[model samples]
Target: MSWYVYILKCSDNTYYTGVTKDLKRRVDEHNGDDKKAAKYTKSRRPVRLFWSEPHESRSSACQREAAIKRMKRTEKVALASRV
Candidate 1:
């Protein structure tokens, strides 16, 4: 399965990083009115996808997500712009 590292711009202007096996479905899930969605995102209500990178392994995707999460907001925006 292809893993994806994704970044979402929350309604509050905060960024969130996560990995998923199916990027579209995951994004839909985040937008859905489901209690299972992460509380952070659930309240954000709507999230705009700012970036995505496909990876051969979930571990790699997760590592990338962590790295992106560590970046300052401006740097993260630049990284996302490259996608």
Candidate 2:
């Protein structure tokens, strides 16, 4: 199965990074009010998908997510623009 590292632009203009096996379902979870919604994203509701990159394995996707999370906001924005 394909894994993905995704970036979301929150309603407050902040960004969130995560990994998921199903991008659509994950995004839905982030946007929904359900228990699955991340606390960070739940408050920053109505987030839009800014970028996503595919990976062959979950480990790779998680690694990418960690790298993106460590990046400065400007760096993340630049990366997102290239996607």
Q: Please, what are the lDDT tens digits per residue for candidate 1 over residues 55-77?
A: 99988988998888889999988
Off by over 4 Å in 2: none
TM-score of 1: 0.91
TM-scores of all predicted structures: 0.91, 0.95
Candidate 2 yields a Cα-based lDDT of 0.92
lDDT of each: 0.86, 0.92
In candidate 1, the residue pairs with backbone N, CA or C atoms under 3 Å apart (3 or more residues apart, or in different chains) clash, namely none
List residue ranges in candidate 1 displaced over 4 A.
none
Error of 1 at 6 (Å): 0.1
Tell me how far candidate 1 lies from the true structure as C-alpha RMSD in angstroms. 1.2
The candidate that wins on lDDT is: 2
